[model samples]
Target: MTGWCRRVRRFVSGRHPPVPSLLFAAAWAYGVTGLFAALDPLAARWRPGGGTAVAAVTVFLDLLLMRALDDVRDLEHDRRFHPERPLPAGAVRVRDLVVLYAAGSSAVIALNAAWSWRAAVLAAQLAYGAAVLAAHRRWRWPPGDRLLVNLLVSLPAPVLLHAYLYAGYLDASGHGAGWSGAVAVVVAVLAAGYTELAKKITRAPRPGEPAATGPLGLNGSVAVALAAPALSAGLLAARSQAPSAWTPAALLAMVIPAVAGCRFLLGRARRPCAAPALHLLLTFAGYAALGLAR
Candidate 1:
């Protein structure tokens, strides 16, 4: 048991890094939910409470669960390319991740079940995640070798998660999503997909590593990366009740991705990968602040 615990710890440290992962989860949960509550005319006065806390915990666990499942699903691929990763290095075993997924998913389901109608959304997310795993294991149809197709297939997971968060906010506030909710979900999804693409737009990827540069080329990849956040921000501004207040922040946030793209073009590869992450974090944080200020 001690050895198993240690292995899990190794995996967490090497792959997930608890501190940043928790921060990302909390930011996503609170930031997205807060934005929905603040932006939705019907839920403008909604504030975080017990349901908010529950949602944060659920997001954190769901992230860990997804990480575990992905690591397991890609174990063979990692052995070929990322041999030093925890699972490939023998620091963690498949069964260890399986246990983690089982426990974490059970907690997620139970938490959402007790909280609100968010359970139905959570169920759909879980079903989609399971189907992805099963499909990957059975036939590998999406083909990890094709970065674009694999990313497209993977996009729904985050999209469903955003929907789940929106649903939780609605349930807690006793409101309907309306068109505002739909717009917020689209914005959040675009932000997420943009971040995913941005991180993969490296000029010099390690051999066999999946990168958008390979499929879209650096210029094309960077262009698409820049486009997503811009589109997302435009939608938010159009939908926002007080666009003047948030528009500046949105514009400033846009500079991060642009700078990151320029850095990639200039061959400064080391730090550019982190740009989208910071951009997304700031965008979400800005949204939460906007909601609270209003």
Candidate 2:
């Protein structure tokens, strides 16, 4: 048990930091349920504890699988560019990671299966992940194409999460998230993409190093991030069900990255720093609160 715990720690340290991962998963649970509440309050009404557990587990497993796959795929690149990373540094073996991945997959399947037929949602996520990994193995896109690649890779994430929640909610409440739920899903996807772009904004790359997402500079990244909230606000407004719930969050979402972008522009900071990510975490909380508020 001790050895197993140690390995788990290594995995967390090496792949996903524990604090951020847990926080992100918690926020996601709230946001997903909150969106469900907004779209269909009656449908969203269900046993809180069970719903929370399902969302937390689904998000955590999704993140874990993504990190593991990325680590595995980028083993060589990490060895060269990020030598201190666990897999490249020889702190953990690929075999161990594979075992963990398999175990995680099983757990995800079982959790979703028990929750509902929603295990199929996780299965779709797994399928997309596998396809991306296969592509990475075959043709490594140039760094210039990194932005597009990142977007494509992440596009399915919101769908999977939504499907997971939607399926479970249906099973529990015998109703669906409705059309507004689609808007929430779009908002989630755009938020994720924006965060991806924000993280890749580099304050300073070495002489030979390119911008993290190729040619996308601070301004472009910020713009990408800003677009999410603007669109989300519009969607929330159109729904008219709980505009109050999402309005502030949408505005704040736009503001956080915008402020970070300005700082990056003025040379006050390098990259968007952690502002965009932190904002995303807050947005999740806001959405969750909005759900509960309703």
The numbered model that scores best in lDDT is 1
Give the per-residue lDDT digits (tens) of candidate 1, residues 1-294.
Answer: 898899999999998887898888888888898778556766656567887788888888888878887887888888988899999999999889877776777778888787556787777787788788889889977776666787888888888888888878777777566888888888888877678787656666677676645557777777887889889888777666544666565455677877877776778763465787899899878777767755
Can you write out model 2's per-residue Cα lDDT over 1-294, one digit (the tens) per residue? 566557667877867887778778877876766766665645444345676776786788778877887787778767767888888887777767766777888888887676446788788887777677767777864233376666666677667867777666566567655676676777666666667676666666655555664555656665766676667656654553454645565455666766777777778546545786787776676566556555
Local distance difference test, candidate 1:
0.78
Model 2 misplaced regions, further than 4 Å: 1-8, 41-47, 141-145, 213-218, 243-246
Instruction: Assess every candidate by TM-score.
Output: 0.91, 0.86
Worst 10 contiguous positions by lDDT, candidate 1: 242-251
TM-score of 1: 0.91
In Å, residue 35's CA in model 1 sits off its true spot by: 1.8
RMSD of 1: 2.1
